[model samples]
Target: MAKGKLVGKKLILLGERDGIPGPVMEACLKDSGADIVFSVTECFV
Candidate 1:
């Protein structure tokens, strides 16, 4: 298996999911070894 370069990287995640929050995506990023320093999401209803 290959390792990722994000093993100790800082990230700022500003993501949206079809105008909604993407918790799953956020989790995936975190799982990839990124430390979320800031995050923001938007939702439309």
Candidate 2:
């Protein structure tokens, strides 16, 4: 597994679902070892 240091950074993921990430997006972020601070989804508009 690839690993890196993420001490004080913010990650904002905006999508259509909650607690579920898209495959491609997940893979890219996983490779970078980012610390996800926020994950949000839009319900309408």
Candidate 3:
């Protein structure tokens, strides 16, 4: 069996490098019931 970090834990997304600039990805995650503990508009990666 494999234990996951996000299992039953509050989610915290630092950055979502969508290969573009915008809050599209962030919004999508929020709609999907994500906690979104932390986030950034632009990611370094």
Candidate 4:
């Protein structure tokens, strides 16, 4: 992965069930050098 803009930043990822999921986003950012405070996937009707 290329250098991430989130390097050394803290984040909270909120994902949607119909969209990108939280865990998936986390995986993408795992190597971004950011501290993920939390990740959640919310479902909507």
Candidate 5:
């Protein structure tokens, strides 16, 4: 992803268990200059 694309923004990530997890997504976006409100990993099975 482009750096700082989410700069000065707030994020609420909803991730999947089989796909990218919340923490992983959070890590990837950590350098995006965004404030993560929360990250949730949901399981659908």
Candidate 6:
């Protein structure tokens, strides 16, 4: 398995209810070994 390059890096994801990166972001998280920490989303108002 390829070791994560961001093992100690911090990651944050901010998305809208209809964001464009939902799937891609998920894939990144799955492949990441970094401390995948927090996520926040807000509805378009």
Return the top candidate by TM-score.
5
Cα-based lDDT for every prediction? 0.69, 0.56, 0.52, 0.92, 0.91, 0.65
Which candidate would rank higher by lDDT, 2 or 4? 4
After the best TM-score superposition of candidate 2, give how far the Cα of residue 21 lies from its true spot, in angstroms: 5.9
Clashing pairs in 5: none
Tell me model 1's lDDT, rounded to 2 decimals: 0.69
Candidate that beats the other on lDDT, 2 or 3, i.e. the better one: 2
Write model 6 residue lDDT over 1-45, tens digit each, in one string: 437677677777766777744445656676666655666666777
Worst 10 residues of 6 by lDDT: 19-28
Question: TM-score for every candidate vs. truth?
Answer: 0.58, 0.41, 0.39, 0.82, 0.83, 0.51
Where does candidate 6 clash, by residue pair? none
Candidate with the larger TM-score of 2 and 5? 5
| RMSD of candidate 3 to true structure, Å | 6.1
Over 6-41, each residue of candidate 2 has an lDDT whose tens digit, in order, gives 434556776555545544354567556576656655
Clashes of each: 0, 0, 0, 0, 0, 0
Kindly indicate the candidate among 3 and 6 with the higher lDDT: 6
Q: Which stretch of 10 consecutive residues in model 1 shows the poorest summed lDDT?
A: 17-26
Ranking according to TM-score, highest score first: 5, 4, 1, 6, 2, 3
Among all windows of 10 consecutive residues in model 5, the one with the lowest summed lDDT is 1-10
User: RMSD (Cα, Å) of candidate 5?
Assistant: 2.9
Give RMSD to native, each candidate: 3.4, 5.2, 6.1, 2.2, 2.9, 2.9
Error of 6 at 24 (Å): 6.9
**What's the ranking of the predictions by lDDT, best on top?**
4, 5, 1, 6, 2, 3
Q: Residue by residue across 1-45, what tens digits does model 3's lDDT show? A: 324453345555454466643355557655454455665556574
lDDT of 4 by residue, 1-45 (tens): 447688889999999999999999999889888999999999977
lDDT of 3 at 26: 57
